[model samples]
Target: MDIKVLGPGCPKCHETERLVKEVVAELSVDASVDKITDLMKIAGYGVFGTPAVVVDGEVKSVGKIPKKEEIKTWIEG
Candidate 1:
C-alpha cells in the first residue's frame, strides 16, 4: 500500500507523519509512506489543503489530522 501525507513541513504534518509510522509499525503492514512538501506535487493530487492523507492515490482526508484507527483502515483497505 502507498500512503502520502501532504504538507509543507508544518507541525501538524510532522505529527501526521509520526502517527502514520506508528500505526504502520503497530499493524505490521507493508506500505510506503511519503511526505510531500512540494506545492506542485500536492496540487497534482487535487488537494488544496495541507495535512492531507492519500491512500493508494485516493484522497482520504484533508486539512486535519486523522486518527490512527481511521488511517489503519485506509492502509488495510
Candidate 2:
C-alpha cells in the first residue's frame, strides 16, 4: 500500500506521520509512507489544508491529526 502525508512540516503533520508509522507497524502491513512538503505537490492533491493523509492515491483525511483507530481503519480498508 502507498500512503502519503501532505503538509508543510508542522507539528500536526509530524504527528500524523508518526501515527501512520505506528499504525503500519501495529498492523504489520507493507506500505510506503512519503511526506509531501512541496506546496505545489500538495495542491495537486486538492488539499488546501495541512496534515492530510492519502492512501492508495485517495485522500483519506485532511487538516487534522486523525486518531490512530481511524488511521488503522483507513489503512486496513
Candidate 3:
C-alpha cells in the first residue's frame, strides 16, 4: 500500500502524518508512507485542501483530518 499525507507542514498535517504512521505500524501493513509538503505536488493530486490523505493514488480524504478508523478502512481496502 502507498499512503501519501499532503500538507504544508501545519500542525494538523503533522498529526495526520503521525497518525498514519502509527496505524501502519500497529497493523504491520507493508506500506510506504510519504509526506507531501510541496504546494505544486499537492495540487498535482487535484487536492485543493491541506491535510489530505491519498491511498494508492486515490484521494481518500481531503481538507480535514480523518479518523483513525477511516484511514484503516482505506488501507485495508
TM-score of each: 0.95, 0.97, 0.96
Model 3 TM-score is: 0.96
Per-residue accuracy of model 3 over 12-44 as CA lDDT, tens digit each? 999999999999998999999999998999999
* CA deviation > 4 Å runs, candidate 2: none
For candidate 3, list the clashing residue pairs, or say none.
none
If ranked by TM-score, best first, what sequence of candidates would result?
Answer: 2, 3, 1
Question: lDDT for every model?
Answer: 0.91, 0.95, 0.93
Estimate the Cα RMSD of every predicted model relative to the unseen true structure: 0.8, 0.6, 0.6
In candidate 2 the C-alpha lDDT for residue 50 amounts to 89
Worst 10 residues of 1 by lDDT: 68-77
The candidates, ranked best first by lDDT, are 2, 3, 1
Q: What local lDDT score does residue 39 receive in model 2, on the 0 to 100 scale?
A: 96
For model 2 the TM-score comes to: 0.97
Poorly placed runs, candidate 3 (over 4 Å): none
